[model samples]
Target: MSSAQVALLPGVQQFLDRQHGLFIDGAQQAAQSEKRLTVWDPATGKAIATTADANAADVDRAVMSAWRAFVSRSWAGRTPAERERILLRFADLVEQNGEELAQLETLEQGKSINISRAFEVGCTLNWMRYTAGLTTKISGRTLDVSIPFPPGARYQAWTKKEPVGVVAGIVPWNFPLMIGMWKVMPALAAGCSIVIKPSETTPLTLLRVAELAIEAGVPEGIFNVVTGSGTECGAALTSHPHVAKVSFTGSTATGKQIARVAADRLTRVTLELGGKNPAIVLKDADPAWVIEGLMTGSFLNQGQVCAASSRIYIEAPLFDTLVSGFEQAVKSLQVGPGMLETTQINPVVSQAHCAKVAAYLDEARKQNAELIAGNVGPDAQGFYIPPTLVINPDANLRLTREEVFGPVVNLVRVTDGEEALRLANDSDFGLTASVWTRDLTQALNYTDRLQAGTVWVNSHTLIDANLPFGGMKQSGTGRDFGPDWLNDWCETKSVCVRY
Candidate 1:
């Protein structure tokens, strides 16, 4: 498509034309260092914009600004109702600019624009509303206490939830606006100031979000963003003394690094990391349903989701039907730029990622694994890797075990549910899994037996505002949903008084 033919949100080009900077204290601040990261449009593998690359100094500046805000009680000082009002306005602003945010998400992150609108913009509004509503409802409990510390002394005890102070949220590249809100809303609802570091590759939308936050009357420095690489800015932000909490969503290895950095400060940390999730198809399941479920499950966001179910286990009896149906379904998906409403499989974020994912598929062929369906599309232009299905995968291959984070699927035949459970549970990652069956007993059995954080009966990737979404074990700790999830962003303070 020619530049003249391509359509964009009216605000997109105007926004991208400016030199992107680190967002701090409700303004765009130039990076102290001269380094800048080129923002790539994965669909065309073209440089769309350039943003300042933050170093440790910039991270320190952002974190310190957040600390000053927290200490000043600029945001946390607001009454629950006032805070709620601000957050509601923030959500409203986000909705008002929905077209532009969704466009930036699709342009930078390479998910379908329809998905960017529905899942990204649509879900974010609902989530923000839900989170905002919880603001006034946050409360404390008074407990009856019997104190023997002193003669004739009556004791009263209570526990209250307090914001955990400045939070440092490290978001992954996929679902930038949606997941960034996942981290931001809860922290904001809990009355904590935050400094978020977006994935350098997809930092544009969040920068715009920061600007909108200020427009919504959020106090300066309460919501800051540092755009840079993991080694420099990320390490500094996670290790900063003033940041009371660190919430990261990324690879397990990087999660561990963040954990280690936060551990030094004894800062609270929440990690939602990598997964090699499993999807099981039972004998009683409809092959068509399995195919449809796996379409989103295995290939949503080009399989970049941490909870994406790539390793599929189908019952032996239903193997041929499910496999053949799935193969056709995979092949039928439209692979193209995310902006098109018809496109299903957009590129995998970048060419480097394309190569990394393709390497795994190449290994599958080297091991004589059956290529059921899929093709890494045209190499010269876009970073497109359409839905790929590989059968006859060996248990020992890296392709079988590692988190591919791409459009690659591996199907295995399981003799029974027990076999499925055994094979699925044998993974280092336990982010999420699903079992498709009509038998309530069989599905319920796998629900407990499956070694994953979130288990679905017949669905996958269907997230809600109330779901306590987090990973178990290597998938990482701390959830990001519900009132309980909001609590993770706060600290419990017990108050005792003698009267």
Candidate 2:
């Protein structure tokens, strides 16, 4: 908390004062409604910028533009090598502006500037380059089907993967820049044009990135940004007839709403929804390593991560050791503004979000849950919440059952890894889960039984560029990385010819 605050770069200052507009068809314009939303810096809770709040009309324009581009093959028609070059150029531009984007994300999304740089911007740079690498890999297979429909006719048949069409991406406020790219990058790699609707609170970085796409030589309508509330623009974009697929990352409730709307049109959807993600510490795991891994997985970005391990199940014999370790680790976190170099826990994105986390804590206290650490009182400014560690939470408590999406972690004791796996798989949300063990067999045993996407052994929250990420069960559908992402973004067409 004593660390000095980092000075703002001039680019961040200019962006903070700018009045931004919706990006459609490679052009920026005021929203049709002319309504706007003020941007805020979470560290100071100050209004820093304003951006157009697109209404239904603006949604229509963006979608239609993307649809036209898709239909006309403006972006999709390009050769894979051409697409790869442009995407690589875009990645390079993002890398060059990394500092500006990281600061802007910290200002808008409320994570530490260091995290914004390392995880948000830095990881995004990697994903962008990886997705660009996937351009040539987006392909189909040659299949041989035996048939006797015509006695002496020979048949040549094959299958091809084609871009689905115009895509609609709705991103959440937490880690906006990174998650937005999760939706945008793959769709582009598969040659599908896209329109992104960033969360109202964290729209600035995406808006800036869209403009940079132009500098990277991406065509108009290939990458678009629309900023507005979910009810207005989000709903409009998802349900639009021209949209072939909608990729959404948010709460379970909102994801369901989008699925319902997309259902009417049979539109494909890739939803990364809510998670009560679990981290299991088996009896054989070292307490020291478990403590360090959980500290990063649960407290990074102040635990705004959807895949964050909020619900932790420790084997009974090792439970107290971990509880003590986590308590001390949580207490040691330097809670302050993210711009400060020494700040380990930053404020949540908004006052409303802070209050939401507060309500859960209040309810946990009422349910007789024990808080061993993270009750370091309020900061003088901003929407801050201490990194809270709760134990002995009531079985029925929402703190243990739901995704707090904040720096609140719940610890439960289990008899063994069996019990830990059982309890971990006991949630409706299974976006991610991790198991820690020295036994390779035990870890491999979990691969088939964890019932979640992206299970990790000995680590958690480590998202790799080559691995596929997404939830199973209600954690949501579809994958987000590597070749699995391309599968979701494209449709396969089987062609047969008689020669």
Candidate 3:
């Protein structure tokens, strides 16, 4: 790579040198344990900074603070319109600071700066605005009661949607700002105070956002962040007595552990876990379009996306042609640091993740899975893996069965759309899947049978704030985004009276 290819944004180093702390109550605080974790830049395999590592005590303090804020109703007590204005202002702050946040995100998480700006900061701004709009729209209903009572007696009943109290928002490493917003915005929009636990690997953007929230006039303690590991901080948040609901986005295994902890407390929980999402290319789909969708679907975020099109099935007629195009696209991607404007494949988040992704390639070799495209090892110093593709792997093989969570995808030849659906629905995970076809009838038919939470036609990995997004089966539980999320963050209370 040349100097121009590795060029970084100015001031990235300055931003990293600043000390970061856990955001609790309305301020930044050192963890009671006085421990910290080193934030790494996977793009260069370098340590960026150390962040305060909170433990159980810190979690308890933050949760209590959130609970206090909720009960005091400083934020919850505000009129919907008032809350809306405040959050909209927060969105403005996010937009104003977009470049800074995007830089931090790219450096901390090793995703392309373009993505960090367009998807992370830009999408989060949209999410905050959308959730702000929801504040005014969150409502309950008046119900007509059927009562067998004395003549002329009248009874009426209505329901009030109440916030679920203090919320524990556990976000994952990928798309830290967006997922953090997804977890916290809805809870706050529903008038619930929240304590956010960002993945230790990527905490910079969330911490900054919390500060911006305060500046935007969100009441102190309405949003808090406790940075630490899953064992100490996350476990504490899950079981905190003040935490009425737990919203998490991470691995299926971790989600299960959190679910068990939440279950013990009977806490309301919403989980968005892992996915081995499938993208099917039907025979009738345009070659050029399907090829574009396949490349974007599989390689976006270096395939770190939970709902990435990691597993692809193509009808036999189009498999060879589509795979050839995909291979060319994969080969053309420029792999380098995120700050490089031309870099298409940025480094994976960490060395450990890169190794984990490599193990799948080793397994593929052992199973004689045809290597369609990719480099098994990093060509550069950072935790990088070239976009990888595999073909002809056995249906039950680990390569096809597991979530690689890297820049790797599997291509399988199917007889037709029906066979494609059968193979696509075979996974235990069903977070998302996409079908490319011009046949509306076949697309709808496959859409009805594709066992995933969000299915796309002629597109992949596209999401919006107005839509509900979640997983089915082992992929995880409950919905996020849109009105349904507001309901999930709230409890419906029925009131009836007789006159």
How many clashes (backbone N, Cα, C below 3 Å) per candidate? 0, 0, 0
Question: What are the TM-scores, per candidate, against the unseen true structure?
Answer: 0.97, 0.97, 0.96
Stretches off by above 4 angstroms in model 3 are: 1-12, 149-151, 375-379
- lDDT (tens digit, per residue) of candidate 1 on 1-499: 6442247966899899889889998899998979999999988888999999999998999998999999899888899999999999999999999989999999999888888989889999999999999999888899998878778889889999999999999999998998999889999999999999999889999999999999999999999999999888888888888889999999999999888877777999989999999998889997777888888888888888888888999899999887788888887887778887777788889888989998988888888888875544554368876688888599988989999998888899999978889999998889999999999998998898888889998899777888888888799988878667778887899999987
lDDT of 3 at 242: 85
Which tens-of-lDDT digit does each residue in 163-263 have in candidate 2?
99999999999988888888888889999999999999899999999988999999998998999988898889999999999999999999999999888
> What are the Cα lDDT values of the candidates?
0.88, 0.88, 0.88
**How good is model 1 by TM-score?**
0.97
What is the C-alpha lDDT profile of model 3 across 351-375, one tens digit per residue? 8998999898888888787886654
Per-residue error (Å), model 2, residue 258: 1.0
Deviation (Å) of 172 in candidate 1: 0.5
Evaluated against the true structure, the overall lDDT of model 1 is 0.88
Residue 94 lDDT, candidate 1, scale 0-100: 95
